[model samples]
Target: MALQLIALSPIVLISSYLPFASPSNFSYPAIFNFGDSNSDTGGLVAGIAFPLGPPNGQTFFLKPSGRFCDGRLTIDFLMDVTGMPFLNPYLDSVGAPNFQTGCNFATGGSTILPAKANSTSPFSFGIQVAQFIQFKTRVHEILAQDKKIQQFLPFEEYFGQGLYMFDIGQNDLDLAFYSKSDDQVLALIPTILAEFEIGMKELYYQGARNFWIHNTGPLGCLPRIIATFGMDQSKLDEIGCVSSHNNAAKLFNSQLHARCVSFQGQFPGANLTYVDIFSIKSNLISNYSQLGFKQSLAACCGYSGLPLNFDNRINCGETKNLNGSFVTAEACNNTAEYVNWDGNHNTEAANLYVSSQILTGKYSESPLLGDSHLLAISEI
Candidate 1:
């Protein structure tokens, strides 16, 4: 399959000094994001008052910035290319955030299907889409009543011009593994993708024309999964990852890719691009030493222990009493040297590398090298 690049329709800009100006020929007036922690800017923290305390954002933001990772995610890197401000969470009302460019409905621990009773996040994929609808409706409502606040809200046309991005489904697969057998989990992929299709259809009907969809990465390689399932030697793969989990992820991605291909035909006016995040991340894990990462599977911000260093009870940036001693899951001395950040997320360095690969268009089904619009974005 040819790598399908993100091709946006060119819109003439009157001013070159606009804050949302894109250096590239293509200009996405805004970006509407949806998914889990992989792309969540801050929805989880603001929505439920989740305590994502210190050391989470110490490397980049130098404070708790609502991200599960230590720094910016791959979505953040992609947003920088458009020269727009980092998207504010839809649930966040603090600081009177300006949503002129975009809003993020993603939350940490979100799933495509409605969450279970004990789930940490209540804003499931369906809820996130509902929030987006409310946001769009309110934007128009407020605009109709008053014109003074127009500067802070997205233009009516931005809905069609902006990029709608998704990076979810990892948690859905993870949740299935905890209860269902391998065969049962594989059987659930079709149902999960069906829900995803419904959400896409909703967005398409709502005037969202451009879409950038990312396939889930190798969940088997996550430090959290390996620490929990590693004792069972029979379940391990050649590279020390849980074979069953990886297989499930592959199956999910395969079905998702097919769905995206079909969506192109279903939504005639939409540009749906499916990015292969699995290959990029799997390669990084398999060749970490060659890629300048010291720890491939171990977490940088996790409980202090050899190998994986992940404790389910003691999350990253958390302190607890263990074995008559107080142990805090502090971050490692060097972050860039580790691929995994806190067992479940990737490090800032890893995210940067992944975004670079995305821009190269090599990970996509189509070529990205010679596209003038793609080459203009800063490589960093």
Candidate 2:
């Protein structure tokens, strides 16, 4: 039976989840995001003074926008569809950012677990939640001090009314896979979820009631994973992804789905929707050609120009010395043709496609609660 299923195309497996455009009036006043590079707008750059050079945001912003992608992220699309302005990073105090609608606490390279000395971002899930709490408190405090500033900060009621989006846990799995065997990493899933739950509970305690959580994507399919582990052909799946890594992601998603289901009853009046990002991304990669993508698993902005085009020593927009010669990992001529952007991130075009899938509400375990404008924007 398993062989028969594996033999079937990915399109067949995902046919049932086809999204339909529906007209609805659902809406949220604000949105709060917590995650890593996948959803980060500029949290990492604002928080730690990190620099993301050009070509990272050339596709959309025409310059680096602190996002890992060449264009907008799924969160950016979500905001646009919902009629909200781009969320201001909580740590960004410059540019007179207006957080009246929402604020993002996500940072690149963040994880659910506590950060180690060498962790990419010191802002772990716990730290992000703490920042959210601080943001909420300060917003109210400043509002109380001056009524005129109410237009710049979120209302106290928006905390409970707004959408709380989560896209973390991928980095946690990446960290686990770095040190432990597959089984050991599997064993750590519960602990990671426990920490995730703690952070959710903290937010719930702080008056957040609507949660939209995205399960981790197919980690094995990432160009970075393939380039790092694909030397062993036996380890690759039928679609050329690292089988063990994807299996781990599947297990994590299952456990996360169950947890989201439980949160509904545990937190009264809370609306929790668990999104199946794995299926969406896996299907996209599985049928990239049919979807109009030229490259499925290769990074558009990477070195080597190989099948995967990834090099650990070189990152997008950074020049590195290889064999005493400087080589810059430049963006490809057309980013829309490729799915992967910098080995780990998606291109703006791919992110838009993924967000369109999400807005369909079919991949969501429960019916999605989105604004009416989202329905219109999804068509694009």
Model 2: how far is 196 from its true place, Å? 0.5
Per-residue lDDT tens digits for candidate 2, residues 114-169, read 99999989999999999998888888888889999888888888998998999999
lDDT of 1 by residue, 329-373 (tens): 999998888889999999877886677667666666511221223
Error of 1 at 259 (Å): 0.7
- Model 1 stretches with alpha carbons more than 4 Å out: 1-22, 366-380
Model 1: how large is the Cα RMSD against the reference?
6.2
Error of 2 at 115 (Å): 0.9
Model 2 Cα shift for residue 58 (angstroms)? 0.5
